[model samples]
Target: MSNPHPLQVERRGSGVPILCLHGHPGSGSAMAVFTEPLSTRYHTLAPDLRGYGQSQVQDPFEMADHIADLEALLDREGIEECLILGWSLGGILAMELALRNPQRYRGLILIGTAARPRGNYPPIPWWEYVNTGIAGLINGVKPGWQWNIDTFGTRSLFRRLLKQHTPTAYHYLAHAGTPAYLRTSRHAHRALNTALRQGYNRLADLPTLTMPCLMVAGADDINITAQSSQETAQTLPRCDWHCFPNTAHLFPWEVPNAMNETIHAWLRQQNL
Candidate 1:
């Protein structure tokens, strides 16, 4: 396979496109965040990046390659310039694309992303280990008080929210001895493999971007610290950095209301 394209894409609404790119360890299905709220106000596009979710696994996957796929995707969709919104890995890719081809993006939104030179942030030591970060996050999100689990500190909140992304989250979790729909953990290994073998470290090559930017960070985000988010916001010439004080790395899941308001405010800022 030369280079397969990403999976199904949905384009809705009718204004400057807001292209949403999701992070890894999950499908683009999480795009429901923007799709639900902003769909009526602006044209929204969300594609499962290669090897993620339902997208076809494209080899030689890297930030630059993903940028190419996104460019092609936009051209195919007739989007000249749009509000580029990316989360985590998606955010980093959006920054790269916007920096390389400034005209391609009307604005940029960095959610849990960083540009090394412009932002004093560290890339994940091993992209293959991305899932571990997510797992640790999921475990941490569990409401708790006793910090020492090793000292027999068991919080019951986890016993409840543990199933937040299960079944449909991962599908299949239940019963004394019965089973439901099984969840297939597909494409993860391929993506992680791509991460381990090929990683990105370039930062100084970035173009000075002047697009109206919105940097949303979860104040309690452990994966990508708040400092990193602010640093990224400062890099963009025009940025409005808003830190959700009570949110986590998975802020969309943790603070949907605030995220919605912030994006809505951005839409107003975009005059969309």
Candidate 2:
């Protein structure tokens, strides 16, 4: 395989390194909320995956490519080992990283994620379907979904899907109005489509993960159900699962203080 394009990273604080990975249609900025808090105690390194944010865009935006990009980033940083905290699609990539390089990570923190892509997505609401179709059509004409974000501002149709799952944090979690946001969204669309076609499933490999793992889920997350998180936790050899009541997909954003506290406590307990 060819080398992945260089990634742009946001580095903060200094201590045990924590590699933070963001979800689809988002850049390293998506994880910015946690960086400052995590930075106080640990070295937080958040990278914009290839073709996202300021990273170079390339072809074949698949999971493997994502994995390679991370590997290269770690190497570049001279980080032989670090803790990984991934959210949503980022969690899937974190798992893939552990599978490929088990010795390189100290532990895993998965938030609002599942062990695999759940094919049973509920039917799209009529209003959402119409708006999404319109957005897609417009985005198709203009490579990036910039027009959508520009026209709609903070209430862009692309981000509206998140509103259902992250009502409180929807606006707070909106993508920055930057060229990188548009570029990332365009690349993310391709990467997600490829991921769906590949049918990602890592259940069988979960038991092989011997490192300490923390699975955090939101009870009301409609995107990746709590049931999925529970099932994933059950599969892991060493896992601690926690579900926040009344919270949804963007629990970290919704309750950053609480989330950071929990994570700090967990890391201290693990001595990592």
Candidate 3:
């Protein structure tokens, strides 16, 4: 929690608090997809995760390190009550924080989120090495380097990914420090390996969480399979799951209006 580089956070609007959590391969600004729309009614607080965007980088690669940072940030900002919204990896961290300390938040909106990542199962972790090898090749980076972010994407991949996000997404992508997203992706894969080695699993912990939750999933997300989606839905004590038809993991960016309205409605419904 000392001088956390990835914990960079920004406040927006002037109403009920809404904490926006971004995904892996992203900084806090990734919430740019929702802020403009939500800020109209709800105050939005978006933070770059440790080692992602304008946030400070630090030691201890575990996600719990981030939970601590979030708690500290909230305390400092006098944000004692809020609605929690998280996408992708940020979703995982959100659930972890809520489970560990549910009193801090009023409710949750899970986007393309999961209670547990699919790992250490029928398929071995070897795929990570393969993908990292390929991703490294595509990124022209070897592990253990300082992670030059400029090489994060080739022109083709960048163009394709750019097509899926928004101008705000572009703003985040265009930031000079945003290149860290690529390295974070590579590093998260390795971190996932470390989590597996420690014998920790997301599934076994999901049912322990009793917080009120609303989960929104892309029908076509490759990152989180449909089966896992159902599992996440069932694990919660209070949850409403909505599967976005014909959408992928990038649906929030692809359909920002729909995502924004859905989230606003959820918050209003919960009165958070």
Candidate 4:
């Protein structure tokens, strides 16, 4: 296999290692609020995956390459084993990692992740076209249209959508402010295209996983539905599933404290 770009990591605290992975179009910084609080008890390491944040950009962002990058990160850190807290795309990668090397993982914390590819080509919403057109027009006339759309515009739209589900959580995400390194249009498109082309589905393999897992979903998640998480929970041998009412796909960002507390409590119960 070819070498991947060197991963940029944010490390804090000292104790059991816990790797934090972020979603597509997001950087390790996006996960900072969630990982930072746990620093006191657990050694938290969040990395910027290839083409996102401070990490080097590379073409052909295949899932295999991501898995390899993670392996390299662990080897570089000299971590024999650690726990994983994955959100969205990160959650998918975490599952893949566990399947590839179960012994290296102590437990899994998956939030708003699907066990398999929901479909080859999911339907694009009609509103998205309108949003794109509006964004394009604004960008054409304005100098910083791209940044504005990618940052404020995108976050605003998500905040509105999330508000319908969880008002308090929406407020939190709205104030977080989008990071510049996280707004990657090209990388997002490439990653999604690769996953679709590969027919990414791990549903069948879910039953084979024996490690302790915690699956969380937002009841009103528009991206990955809660039903998918429910099904995943049913398939896993030792899994705890929780669906927060009136919460959306960005639950991790919206309610970082709650999510962190829940994860910490679960880890204590598992003695990990």
| TM-score to native of every candidate shown | 0.71, 0.82, 0.73, 0.82
> Which candidate order results from sorting by TM-score in descending order?
2, 4, 3, 1
| RMSD (Å) per prediction | 7.6, 5.6, 7.1, 5.2
lDDT tens digits, residues 89-148, model 2? 889999999999899999999988989645324555566656655654554454344446
lDDT of 1 by residue, 76-183 (tens): 777787888898777887887787789878888777666641222344344325443343344344422123221211222212222123222221112100110011
Clashing pairs in 3: 5-55, 5-56, 5-57, 6-49, 6-50, 6-55, 6-56, 28-47, 28-48
Off by over 4 Å in 1: 1-6, 58-60, 117-207
Model 1 local distance difference test score: 0.60
Q: Report the lDDT tens digits of candidate 4 across residue range 1-272.
A: 45866889989899999999888767777777767787889999999887777875656566577889988999999999999988888999899999999999999999888886342224566676566455434544553444545644454445333523243443333333244223554765587677768776788898878899999988877777888777887888899998887767777755667777888889899998
Clashes of each: 4, 0, 9, 0
Clashes in predicted model 2 = 0
List residue ranges in candidate 2 displaced over 4 A. Answer: 119-121, 129-171, 175-181
Q: What would the TM-score be for candidate 2 when compared with the true structure? A: 0.82
Candidate 3 vs candidate 4: which has greater TM-score? 4
What's the lDDT for all of these models? 0.60, 0.75, 0.66, 0.74
Give candidate 3 misplaced runs (Cα > 4 Å). Answer: 1-6, 58-60, 119-193, 196-200
